[model samples]
Target: MADIIESAGVVLAYGVAGFAVMALGYLALDLVTPRRLSSLIWTERNVGAAIVMSGQMIGVGLVVAAAINASEFQRGLGVGLVSTLIYGLAGVIVMTLVFALVGILTPGRMGATVLEDRDGRPHPAAWVQGAMYIATAVMLTAALS
Candidate 1:
């Protein structure tokens, strides 16, 4: 039906917007880390890098979902997509700023500490940093909603 096709189109548009935002999030994380994020996770098989990246991606997804939910009904599809993109980007910026702030407050660089593996295991700092990203996203999601 025409309605089904229209709904599919909206879904596609939202999907593209979400993907673009997530890509930007990845780039922001890459900028903060000491090494190339892709290389660290893929080539090096680094668990710590993987954990950090996973957390950030989940956080971005939550923000994007919240944005779409909040805007689609109230503002319609076009505004929903735009707001999702904007909110997702904001989430990335906040997460990056939190990373930097943690680095400053902590004894050593947060990024460097998170990426460290000790005795073939990920450092505890990695878990803490990863949780911080999720927590930041939750707060941003609340603000969006």
Candidate 2:
């Protein structure tokens, strides 16, 4: 019980820190770009922001998991490698489901605003972000249990 509580606290701390870092990245980008450029790229910029946030969250989660699972986290290199692959595959599937569900439920323009490219193609960075999420999940699962 105490271990679970401690682990939760660590996860919460990591999550908050990750969010702060993501916000800083967005602020920096906004400050560096001209107003006109910012207006033009606002949508794509938000997408980038989302990707950055996702990476940060996963990175933080991995670190937190490592710290929390230090004693029982001995899965060896083989387990680590396998978990990475499995988590990555699961992450891709989960991401796809999110996209599909959003598309089905939301109205067109609003959906577009939430996330979309001018050309209607999905962003490449989504895949990269998904991999990070998956990798973190894999590491956490192996380490925690």
Residues 101-138 of candidate 2: C-alpha lDDT, one tens digit per residue: 54466554222333344454445544444454446556
Per TM-score, the best of the predicted structures is: 1
lDDT for position 1 in model 2: 100
Each prediction's RMSD over C-alphas, in Å, is: 1.3, 11.6
Candidate 1 lDDT by residue in tens digits, 18-106? 99999999999999999999898888888999999999999999988987887654667777788788878888899999999999999
Per-residue error (Å), model 2, residue 29: 21
User: What TM-score fits each model?
Assistant: 0.94, 0.33
* Number of colliding residue pairs in each model: 0, 0
Collision pairs in model 1: none
Error of 1 at 20 (Å): 0.6
